[model samples]
Structure formats: structure tokens, C-alpha cells
Target: MSVDVYLGLSAIDSRRAVPRATKCHVHLAAKPFVVVGYHLPGDPGAPIGLLCGTRRERPSTIVVGEPREAKLRLARLANFAMDLNGYAAQFMQTPTTSRRALHTHRPANGPQLVVANQATAQWLCDVMGRRLRYLRPDGDRPVHPGLPVAGAHLSFFAGQRVPGSSLVLPLTEILAQHWVTGQLPSLDANLASQLAWITDPGAVAEAEDALPAGPVPDPEWETREFSDAIKAYHQLVDAHPTRADQPMTGTIHDALRPSWDACWQALDLLHSLPPADRARDRWTQDVYQWSRHAERVRSGQAYFRKRPKQLQVFRYLTRLERLTADLSREMALDDPLIMAGHVAAGEALSGEVVTLDLSGRRPSLQVRPHLPFPRPVGTDLFWHLPRSTSPSGPAWPIVRLTTIGVTPEGLITLDVTAGAVRRDRHDRLPQPGQQVVFSPFGPRDYHPDTLPAELPWTHAEDDDE
Candidate 1:
């Protein structure tokens, strides 16, 4: 079992969540846009309400009195989308010397969506984005102009779900990385339950009275309150064509208030934790991706086909693998405690250097792994160079892991090969007694079979729109 999981299991005796991470791995934006949204459970694609804003005290709320009514749904989303799109719009104003410079002189970190979990993201992205983005302004079922823009942006945020992208951060996932609760992985997805265990042991993890943090309401509540509210809304609207409809919207908003409050409380909890060193690096990638997407939108080329072709899928899969590896390498290098997990797994080791031979054609070291696991000769490994002045910052570098000699006691002498030592100008090789760690970083050590440029007939691309 992984160290984090082990720690979580051990935490059961304590009756509280165990903090696996001292620093927050996810990027915490300066002004993260908190979003707590709900949609109809029966018809998941339809949004019922959305509460979003930057401030803690005041949040802008939007509710659709009738989820089935397309125009009303689109109308409610128009202002909400404007609010969401408005978050990104601020960063777009800062002009660049070149159509680059990461979009401006300042860091172009877009609006970070502090949400309950991936389920909430899907409600906003898959359900909302897919529904609205393709709706033509002049179609048979015309939509407000902002709805499509909102849909496209929402889809973009969802697409940023690739590893290391901080645009749409599900708080549950982030909280899991930092603190491991005693509950099952499935239960961890619930923000209120997770926070309950994290905040205070005496606090109830699951209360009978407390509402579930959701994009979907509980069946009991829907039957008891939600259904009645929707029916009342329809009757009131039918009675008066132009009467104020705030009462109807207010009813739905009140039901979702608990979840909305939980999302904000979750953010406040995250804000209390310190950020990881490599978090900035990951956030940089997010800003760059945001800039590129913004430029595409500005160029009027912001369109994602309902069905993407083969090449697109292949490229996306390839990028996902690459970025996932990058995140792992970054995390290992960024956190020593995290690296210790690698040590336990036998993928890496840490100990004082027994012998150092920088004088050789290839710089080398011989040190027994702190936790020795039997391995065959010539296993390729990487030297994790920590806190190096290089831009990569604490890189997992080096070339080969050549087992030069072995003894009957199971001790091994690993001869480091060429291209191993990559350091800043002032950074020299480790001395005879310095501690170090090594691991097989996928991108560095294992060269997976390269993808062919020409596609097979089955996976071939087409000019499908």
C-alpha cells in the first residue's frame, strides 16, 4: 500500500483525518471564484441554480424557476455565465508586448473554480457546457448570446481536468491530497463529510439534518421541498406574466444554501494551508493554456466539435500521459516527504554517499538503498537533484543505473552513467557523504513506443464538424 493510504488506515484509531501533506499541492488563486451549483436529478442536464462570486459575505445567485423551460434556463445562465466569463475577462485585458509573454506582464492565472468535487464540475461542464455551447443564437431554439460563450468557457474549464491544471479545482480531490480521512474513498468525495473529519473529531461527519453538498439534491428533499417549489413557481408564473419571480428563485436558492455555504467553508479551510513549492510551476502551465484558449476565442476559432476525430483523441491521450508524469516528477522533487514514499516503494532510495567518483569520465556514486529491494543488474534510474538553481527547480535528472558489482550480503554498487549529473553553474556534484535519492521518471528513463505520425485506417481522422 502507498504511504498515504497506510497513514490513512492508521488514522482510524485517532478518529480524525491524518494530514499527509504539509503544503497544499493545488494552486490557490489570489481570488478564486467559488461555485456551488445544483441541477435537476431527474433531468441531470438541466441546471436548477448556481451560486458564484469571489467574496465570502455576498454571492451572486441564479436560479431557473423552470428547469424544463429552455428559454428560462438559458436566460438564468446568461447572467451567471457573464459572471463566470467575467472572471476570465479581467486577465484578458492585460496586453502583451508580443501576442505571448504569457498574455500579459502579470501572471495570467485565470479564474480558479473552487468547487465541491468532480461531480459539480460535470454538472457545470458536461451538462451545462454541452447543452448551451452548440446552441446557435439564431437557431430554432435561440439562446442568449452569452449562453454559448459561457458554455464554451465552461467546457474549456472542464477540459483543463488534465493533471496539474488548476482552472477547475475540485476541493475534495485537493483536500484528499493534503489530508487523508478515515472514511472510504467514495465517502471522501463528499465535501461536508471530509471537512467534518478534518476540522474536529467530535464534529459529525454525516449528519441526518445536514444537506448533501451537491449538483443533485437528495431524493427526500426533492420530494419534500424541491418538487413543491417548482410546482408553485409554475403556478405563480402562469398567474402573472410580468409579476416578480424572485419568490420562486428564492425557494430553490434557500434549499441549496447549505451546499453553497459548505463550498465557501471548504475554500476557507484550503486558504489556511500553505501552498507547495511546485504549485507555482503547475499554475504557470494553467495560465499558458488559458492564454492559448483565450487567443483562440479572440481569433473566433473557439469551437470544439461535438465529436472529436481520432488524431485529436490520440494527441489528448498522449498529452495527458506526459503531463501526468510531469506532475509526479514535480511532486517528488518538490516534496521530500513525498519522495520518502518512493523510497518505501523501492522505486527510489536515500542515504549517505559511500563512494563518489566525479573524477571518472562519467560521475558515479555507490550507496545502498535505505530500504533495499532486490533488483536485476543494469536497471536505469534517475538522480533526484533537489533545490537546484535550474528553472525546473529540484529536477529528477541523470542517466543510467549500472550495477557494477554485488556481494553475497545483497549489497550493490551502482555505477552512474553519462548524462546523469545536470546542475546549475554553481551547483557541484555531491560529496562523499551527502544524502540523495533516485527514481525512474517515465519521460526520462523509459522511452515508451513513440506514436506514429500516420494513423491506422480504423483510427484515421476525418473532416467531421
Candidate 2:
């Protein structure tokens, strides 16, 4: 009878084992063949075997073929042996020239190899003993010695003293077990799930509503998304030069366009509001301004190095105006009072000058006003004298007034001189105490004391210097 043994997903040739049993039976003449399982001892090169008890009454010469088929029978007979004196027969899928199996099981699953006859099992155990001596006494050392240790195993395996029979498990399962057992701390599942929702674009608006209304909108999530979109936009522009000029129609561009438009709309709405409304809507205004500023910077329209000082000054002035308007609304002050205060401040800032002492020389004089005025105070002011004109000698009389008040109708009235000059035309005469002294170089030395003292001459420094 042809005997067939089926292993899951694999087939083995059993013809050799069948013949050995039949010969044993025939030689003993009706004595039953006693087939026993055994394993070769040691590494593949030096396999030796030991006797196992007989399965029947016949004295049998050892037989070993594909070893997988005999595992259950050998273990049941109590006849299996490894590392003992017996007739050795070795059966391997591939021949082993060395004392050990040349290849190990693939890492994707694991290794499973067994020996079937008792004599072969003992031979395997004997051969493996020599190889094991060369290995660290600890069985934890790799089966294939001299190979570089895997990085995952290095920390636990290096210099470890391993005992015989202890298994060296693969790192993959060890790490997985550690994580599953809570040996490693993990993020709270509910918080992690909520954060995922918060990051989702569909849920960002709802998340924002859950947060408090601050001076500016909660921009953390929007900013990250906007930044990524901006990077992609720049990359697109760089990759295709014409894309810059083309209307942005791509998905990323379309998504960001609405945000940009919303920002601009907010800014415009804030700007259009009256001062009273702006005061009540300060939080909205702040958010709008912040968005506007960020947009200007992002668009490269307001680079710090590229913006002129004058533009910076203008922006500062505009900010100041807005703040003052807000304060006025808060204080419930009328428009006229606000305007008067602004004009008074301007006058106070400009009312000062220093006259250069030119008593001994040809009477060339220099006048420096402490603050810049929009235009010259008089059409025929001495400093405005013709550049090509000649000047007289050393002590020509010079009149310098530090403060001159101008009426809304353009009347130039000096607080010190107490004299008003109708300064509507270039040929207007200088009033008393406002003598224009001419030198060869032009208007020169002047006596400030000769003018009236009632002028607002609040000098930054005293003349005693």
C-alpha cells in the first residue's frame, strides 16, 4: 500500500521510510518492524544520533527521510533521543556541510524545523553542542554568529549573559507587546480624537466658535493651513513662470482666495465704521488690522528693508489718528475740540529756533528752526532773500523771532513783536522790529532782543549756552 501523509500546504516524499520498514520486517521473518524517531545532534557538519525504544519487536536499522512526518509518532513512542550513541541517519531539505543549518527561518514569520528518528535526533544534538560552545553560553546570542546585531536588539542584547535554552525572540513582537501592555505612555484617546477633529478643515470654524473672542481671531489652525497653501502657491509660481500672471484657479489657490478676500473685506468694513462704532468694535478692528498687516507682508508689499522711512512715518501718523479718534469717541469730545488740540500741539512743537552769533565777521547769519514747518513764514523773509545779492559790513541789524502766530486768514502776527504783517504777497513790508538786514553774502546778523518778547519762544535749550 502506498501511504500518504498530508501536512497543511506542503507535501513530503515518504517512499524511503516505507522501504526501510519493509526490509526490517522481511529480515526478521514476521517480527514486526520497530520504527523509532530520532534527531541529529549538533551543527549540520557534525551530526550524530542516539537509540530510541522500538515501536515493534523487530531490530531495525535506523531510517530517516523528510523529518516532519515522524514528530508525532516519535514523541508518542518515548523512543526519540538527541545527543546519544546510536546509528545516525540525517535527512534535511538541503544537505548541511557544517554542524549547523546554514539558513534560518525568514523573519516575516518564524523558524520551525524538527528531527524524526531518535538516532538522527541525537546526532543533531551532538553536532549542535560544538557550535553552541563557540556561541556565548547564553542561548540569547544569535544563531548566526559574527553578523552585525540588529539596531533594535542592540540595547537589550549587547553584553547580556544568556542561559542555555533561553530563546532570543525577534524585536518586532517584543516592542508590540510593550506597547500593548501600557508599558509605554500613550496620548488620551478622546483628546487625540478631538484634536483630529479640530485640525479638520470642516470642523475648524466650529472649533473657533468654541474658543473665546479675543483681540484677534483664533488663527492657529488657519495660519498653518494658509502657510502650507502659500508654500504651494510659491512652488507653483516658481515651477511655471506664467502661473504668476494667470488667475489662480487651482484647488489650493481657490481655497486660500476666500480667506484673503475675507481679510480684505474685514479691513474695509473696519475702516468704514465711524469712530464711535470703531470703539465698540475694537476687537474686530484689531483683527482686521492684524490680517491686513500680515497680508501686506506676505504679498511682499511691505518688506521692512524695502519700505521707505516716509511711508513708515505716514503709517505711524495714520495709526495715531485712528487711536486719537478712538479716544475722542471714548471721551465724548466734539470734533472742533479735537481739531483745536491737534493744531495747538503742532504749534507747540514748531515754536523754537536758534540764531547763529555773527557779531565780528561779515555778519552772515544762520537760523535753524527746532521743528520743520510746511512752508516759509513770510514771502520776503530774510533767509528767502535773493541768493546773488550783496551784503554790507560786520554789525548789520538782524531781527530773529522764535515764534510767529498765523491767523486762519494768513495774517502773520508775532507774539514778541506785537506787529502783524499782511504776508499775502512777495513784496510785503516787514513790520516794526522785523528789520531785514542785508549782508554781501545775503541777509546776515540779526538782533533777537530788538523784537517784542511776547512771542512763544520755548527753546529746547536756553541761550545761556
Candidate 3:
């Protein structure tokens, strides 16, 4: 176990969240659009409320007075959709001058959608995106123009849910990355509970009349407060078609205030941590993917399809695996705290250089590992090279290991059995007394992304247009 994870296990006694990172891995925009969403207890497609905005003063609240009614559900989304469109428009306004990205060749730099948890992300993309995206604005059963537009965008965000995509930032998941709470890992999905652990480290579950940070509203609050107000509001709407219920909006806003505040509080905590050195570079990839989706949408081509072929699944899984490995390696390299896990597991080690010899036929270095973990001779450990701008080449194996003093210290002697390096390249090499990390980890194998031919009816859904 890593130092933090092992320590976090014992943290149960102290009831404190253990900090897992010295740097924030997720990209946080200066003004990311935070969306706190909720749905009816049993109703997946019917959204009960959404609190959203870039500014924290007071987010624009949208609530479905009666979620059961299909027309009302879609009708309420018009305002929400308009907000999404307006936010996205800011990204597309800047024209790109480069060749289209192979995936989505648009620009780099797109809007970010922050939600409470993964369930809310599912609600936005799967249930809600599917419900509104296929609606024909000009069809016989026409809906608001903004509804389909927002649905399309939300659908695009769903596609961007690969490992480390910044387009959709689930607050709970991101916060969990920075700090592992003493609460059950399952409870980490609850934004309110997680943030409570963060702000008040020893906080425990209490019988407070607080709502969950959710895609589902509190059932008790519904039976005691919301059900009656919503029933009365719908009745009033039926009686007076043109009347606006000013007080009901405030009520909805009040109901959501706890979770809404928690979301921002969590964001503020994340903002306090230093971001990873490569966070911006990773965000650029996110924006690039967003631009590709934008291009597809502008082209008016069908997107959703039911052709989940075997080949497509294989390709997708392969990509996911590659991305996951790359993200983990990068996270460790950029943050020593993360790399400690490998050190604890004996897959990696760190220490100051004791000596270096260039007089022999090959370059060699003696390193006394700080942890003194025994490693087999001839193990190939790549010296951590975060600044290796050169193309990938070959690396040789270690030739010796020795016991220093009588304490059995792991003093390793790594010898390059291949060609010797030029003296002029000494600047790039690790010198004596320099601290360095060496691990078995290496760059993933390179392969061309050439798909097999004879693939059709496997890209998009028939309903997509």
C-alpha cells in the first residue's frame, strides 16, 4: 500500500480525510459553469431541478413544477438549454485555423460542465440527452428549439467522459481524488457528506435535515415540503395559464441551496490546492475533443446509433486502457505523493546518487535506495525522465546489487552494457548527489491507429440527425 492509502486506512480512528495529493490533477477553469442537478425519486427522465451559473452569487434556478407531465418537463428545459448554448457559444466564437482534429478537428478550449457526481452526469447525458436530442423542433409534436440544441451539447459531453476529460467535471469524484475521506468510499459520491469531511475533518453523519447532493431529491423533504407546494403550483398553473409563480422559484432555490453551496465549497477547496504541472496541457486535449463534437454537430450528421460492433468495443477499450495508464504515469511523475505508491509496492525507488563512473566501456551509476527494498539483479529500471523530448529508443539492464555496511542497505549498481554516452550529453544525465526516481514503468508501445476495414452500421444511432 502507498503511504497515504495505508495511513488513510488507519484514519478511521481519527475521523479525518487524508490528503492524497499535493497537486490538483483535474483542470479547473477560472469560471467553470457549475450545475447542481436533481431528478424525481423514481423518475429518471423527469428532472426535478437544476441550479446553474458561472457566478456563485445566485445560480439561475430551473425547476419542473410537475415532473410527470412530459410537456412541462421539456418546456422547463428551454431556459436551461439556452444557458448551455450561450455558454458554449463563447468557445466556438474563436475560429480555428488548423486542419480539423482527427477525432474532432475543431479548436482547443471549450466550456466545462460541473456536476455533483457521476449519477448526475448520467442523468444529464443518458436520460435527459436522449429524451430531448431526438425531438424534432419542427415536427407535429414540436418542442422548444433550445431543447434539442442543449440535448445535443449534453450528448456531446457524454462522449467526452473518457479518463481525464475536463469537459464534464463531477465535483465529488474530483474532490475524492484530492482527499480520501474517513467515511465509507461509497459515501464519497455524496457531495455534501464529502465536503463536510473536507471542511470539518472530524464531522460525522448527523440527523440534520440536510438534502443529499444528488440526481435524486430527498424523499422526506418531498413528502413534507415539496409535494404539496408542487401539487398546489400545478393546480394554480392549470387555473391561471398566464400567471407566474414568483414564490415557487424561491422555494425551489431554497431547497437546493445546501447542495448548491456544497458544490462551490468543494470547488473552492480544490482551487486551494496547486494544480499539476501538466493540467493545462491535458485541458488542451479536452478542448480539442470538444471542438470535434462541435464540428460534427455543425455538419448536421447523425450521432447516436445502435451499432455497437465488436471491433468498435475493442478499439474503445484499448483507448481507455492507454489513456488510464498514461494518466496514472503522468500523475505520478508530476506529483511525488502519487509516485510513493509504487515505491511502497517495490515497483519503484528513489535515492540520491552515491557515485557515477564514465571511465568504463559503458556508463554506470551506484544508487543507494532510500527504502532499502531488495530488488533482483538485472532489473531494468527507467530513470525517471519527465523531460525526455527525444524519440523512444532502447534501454539496458542493471548488472549489480550490493549490501552497504552491515545493515543490508540496497545499494544498486546500474550498468549500461550497450554503447557509452558522449561526454557532452552529461547535462541530461543524473549527476552524483542528485536525487532521482527509477521505476519499471515505461512508455506504452506505439502502434498506428488503423482500423480494420469492412465496418458499417456501427458508428451512430438511427435516431441521430
Candidate 4:
């Protein structure tokens, strides 16, 4: 969170709304597929209904008429799988070609999936995928053919929801990244509360018009409307199988309409702001992963383990941490508003060059930061030069922090140790009064070493060997 956002939140005590950013934090596909659904309250593993499509007005609905019946449930899932696969098929026509080592033969533009929040994404990714992924059409208890396909795709998407990938986007999480609400962070996860803070001042959290966007419906509403509707539906179906469609459709539409409308409104609000620049590069990475996953599926090698081993868990956490740090650095560099948070926190500083000491043997430059430094004297801070500063085209130009001290007037001075390779060329050195910024972040890479196939034994295999 940024200081600007914090101040905004403070100012909005009366209205409970604040704008944390001037631009969108995440990238959205030109035509993104929005999904909203609810599962049975007691049995969250069992899905009740789903509404999905690119446009809200023409969204398709899938409802499980007899959820307890495995065959009937799978049939509904097969219908949804076909719809999703068909949407993805259109992007296969002219796949973006990349000669990169990893993307030799994969589509560059894959389908993007969106949900209301992280919980909904997890429901599809973990719970739903686990339930559907392992069923085989040739097994003793055969299942629908499309169930396995859907499971594979869902499992792939679940794995892709790491820090940098935008393949499986969570709208509430993305919105929270760019805005701050007067309500508590826990309450902001509710779509209605988030949207109310962003758009309507008069609307309260969980307002009647802006109902809960749920994979789990509200208990009171479920008991009243849903229980009656479903009971009536089952009675009609049992009596006349042909006439139940209209009643069921009406019931599903009534339940999902509020959430479905909220999805589009949230998207529209996000679309109005320009995307953060680093988002495109991150999305490209997602495309590469998506292509590779598609190839694996086509090769019949797609499989997601129920749980990872001890070593695999360690490696996954390490990679995830690295990616998350890299993402934070990228976001700071891409947006000044976001960087302001770091600046406020003393993780970064921005100011004008005060003096140049070219005559000295080290040829160091001094900078006076406009922001106050919470760091102690002698603490090192590196200057992050723009890529344009280095003619050799380094991704990030580095400057070693030789010394830092505070002046009598409370301004901090930075002494650069080793960034001036082109000291002779006056153009290379930052001119006095030229604004510069520095932080702990520079250029770095993380590659986890491959684990050995066999664990080394501390002691001999006793008498068993």
C-alpha cells in the first residue's frame, strides 16, 4: 500500500472510498472470459451452477440438476468443458510464434480465465480440478470424456496462478492492489464492498442490489429462495422431465445475475485505467506457460499430483518467493505511484543530484534525497540508473553504495562507489539537478539447482542390504 492511498483512506472516513492508484495494476485481455458461480453450501465440493462468457449480456449458464448423481453432474461439467475448449480453439488459428528456447511450437495467445476473487479461483483450481482430473472413460466407473479434459485445463490454470502469471486473474485481488477502502482488508475481499468503495458512495457493503458474489451462497437466502426453487425444480423434473428447463433457468439466472453484473462493472472500472507497463511482459510469460501446458495435454502427458513431496514443496515455495519479490520490484519500477509506497517506507529514495566529484580518484557523485531517510548513518544504498544510461543495453544499470550520511539540515547524501565506468564522458554522468532514484532492487536471477535423484544415506542400510 502507498502513503497516498493511506492518506486517501484517512480522508474518506465519511464516505469509505479511496483511489490508491492512477493506473491499473494488472493486464486484462481484450476479451476476457468472466466466471461467476455458487456451490452447494454444505458440500462446497459439489457445484450448483456457473455463469461464464466474454460478455455479461450473453453469458451462458450451466446448472447441475441432480448434483448427487455422479453421471448427471459429469454431464453438466462436460457441457461446460466443451464451451471452454471451443472458446480456446479460436485462438489456435494463428498462434503467435516465438523462437525462444521454451516456446518453439506453442500458441502465444491462449484463453484467459477470470473470477471474482482468490477463493473462487481456488475453488476451480484445487477443489474442482481434484474432483475431475483423475476420472477415466475406460475405467470400471466410466465418466464423461470431457470431464478429464476440463480437469486437465483447470489443473494447469491452478498452477499458473503464481505471482507473475495473469492467466487466472482474480478481480478483487487485482482491484485491491490498485485501491484502498476504508473498510477492513478482510471485508474488502467481498466484491460488493470493494465495488461500493470504488464506484457508489451510497451503496453499503453487501447491499440488496449488490448481493454476495459467491461460490458459497448466503445461508438465509439459500434457505428461503434457493431451497424452495430447487425443491420445486426436483418435483417438476420428477413429474415431467421435459418441462423443468424453464423453471431451473429462471432460478439460476436469479441467483447469478447480481454477481454477473458486478463482474462486468468491476472489469469496466479496471479497463478505464491504463495498464501498468510491466504487466505485458508478465502476460507474455503466461502465454509461454499456457502454450507448454497445451502441448503437454496434446501429448497425453498432462497430470497434476494430489500433493507434492517434501523436497518438491521446498522448491516450489522458494521459486514462488523469488517470483513474488521480482514482481514487487517490477511493480515499483513500472509505476511511480506504487514506488511512492517504498519511498515512504524508506526502501527507496528519489531526489536531484547535488554535486559531482569527478576530480577525486574514485569519481563519485553526491545526491540529496528529497524524502527523509529512516536508515542509519553508514547504511549502503545503490542507485538504479535507467537502462538508457548504459549504452551497452544492460537491463538494469547498477551503482554500488560507497557511503551515506545525513547533513545538519536533515537531508541525506549518497556517495556512489562503482557505477561511473564512463567518467571521462561528461554525458554519462548524471548532471546536477537531474532527478535520480535508488533502491535495493537491481538486476538478479534465481535458478533452483536440480535435486539429486537419490538421497544420500547418513548411515549404511543396516542388515537389510
Using lDDT as the measure, the top candidate is 4
| Error in Å for residue 309 of model 1 | 0.8
- Candidate 4 worst ten-residue window by lDDT: 99-108
Task: Please identify model 4 stretches exceeding 4 Å from their true place.
Answer: 1-5, 14-16, 91-108, 205-209, 385-392, 396-401, 407-411, 424-429, 447-465
- State the lDDT at 135 in candidate 3: 86
State the displacement of the C-alpha of residue 229, model 2, in Å, after optimal TM-score superposition: 9.4
Clashes of each: 1, 45, 6, 0
List, residue by residue over 75-176, the lDDT tens digit for candidate 4.
Answer: 787878787767765653433346353233433466789899888999987788888889898868987787787888888888888997788888888888
By TM-score, who's the top model here? 4
**TM-score, predicted candidate 3 vs. hidden true structure:** 0.87
Candidate 3 lDDT by residue in tens digits, 13-58 = 5677777888989888877888887788888887877899888887
Worst-scoring 10-residue span by lDDT in model 1: 95-104
TM-scores of all predicted structures: 0.86, 0.15, 0.87, 0.88
Candidate lDDT (C-alpha), each: 0.73, 0.26, 0.73, 0.74
Ordered list by TM-score, greatest first: 4, 3, 1, 2
**Candidate 4: clashing residue pairs, number:** 0
In candidate 1, which residue ranges exceed 4 Å CA deviation? 94-108, 139-141, 207-209, 238-244, 358-361, 386-401, 406-412, 419-427, 442-454, 458-465
* Per-residue alpha-carbon lDDT of candidate 2 for residues 1-465, written as tens digits (9 for 90 to 100): 111122101111311111101100000111111111222222243111122222222222222221233442132212322211121111111221221112121111111112222222232333333223233223753333221111111111111112110112211121121111111113111111122221233443353344211111125533554345335546665677455322222322333233233222222322332332112233232223323333443353422222234444445455555555444332222122222232233331222222222232222223232333334443222222222222331222222233244456433333222111222221322333343321112232232323232333552235588
For all predictions, the C-alpha RMSD in Å is 3.8, 43.0, 5.0, 3.8
